[model samples]
Target: MERPLKGSAPNADDEQLLRGRVYGRDHDDPDPGPLPHQTYAALVGGPLDGLLLDITGWRTEEVDDGVALITELGRWPGGRALYDPRSGEPRTPGPGVSCRFYYSGDTP
Candidate 1:
């Protein structure tokens, strides 16, 4: 995915591309934020999304259906927004968050 230039807007094609992407998080994890330095995993479907963080040493792999984006979330002692703030549960990475993408089969 491409970020629009400052003060510029995305054209119709960019909008359509974004619409075809999918994102998900671990529903079983109860922590709102990942424990400092702990490994975390999220689900990615459809086309792969772009990186928000240039975190090094991240890994990705193919799954049975979609893809698995795995990374070790760096420590956040205060418990940051890595997870849903409202519910403190793992969920799809949204704005301002970062996740790595891995693919083995077809994607959007």
Candidate 2:
């Protein structure tokens, strides 16, 4: 009955459902469902900020998606998720690089 608002704020009903998920109340159930845009409202909050979630080992395409996710953050106000440099790769920009997921690959 409750769910996160599509591409928008977490509605009152959606918040209730998220609360349950955050506390691991109904976690065993499959399909935690579509994730929240900012990863916070989908029961996926701050823990990731300190973890190693880089695309260093992923294929180029995967890297592109990751970068795009960060770039698109500017498109949505109040969105505050950042991918930290856990792998020690310098996040330098190359000329003509599209705003997509890309691994630094320790090539800097």
Candidate 3:
């Protein structure tokens, strides 16, 4: 199946394209975000409506049916938001402490 953008619902045209153009298609302009990395394997084995997501570039309450929403920003490359802050197990990557920091584009 063709995958859609992360954190957002699939559009009708994209769904149709996935069904229609699974075979060889010509390449176009490059994608906007960094290609998905190995750290993107955390979302699995559950319905995704209420999962705590924390990856970069995802809108809050974003929904996707093709793949699980990414829920971990890389704090230390191999480490992720799932790493527990206290018990050292995989905890949900909720919002970080509300801190005043410099930002470039948009604020969440």
Worst 10 residues of 3 by lDDT: 98-107
Residue ranges of candidate 3 with Cα displaced over 4 Å: 1-5, 27-108
How accurate locally, in lDDT, is each candidate?
Answer: 0.31, 0.31, 0.26
Q: Give the per-residue lDDT of model 1 (tens digit) for 24-86.
A: 333234533333443333323222222222222334322112223332221222111222112
Screening candidate 3 with a backbone cut-off below 3 angstroms (N, C-alpha, C), the clashing residue pairs are none
Higher-TM-score candidate among 1 and 3? 1
Candidate 3 lDDT over 1-108, as tens digits, reads 444443344455543332311112222424321233311212221212212223434332331212212221222222222221122234223343211111111111
Please write out the lDDT profile of model 2 over residues 9-65, one tens digit for every residue.
445554444443322234355754323331221112331111123222345445434
lDDT of 3: 0.26
Q: Worst 10-residue stretch by lDDT in candidate 2? A: 99-108
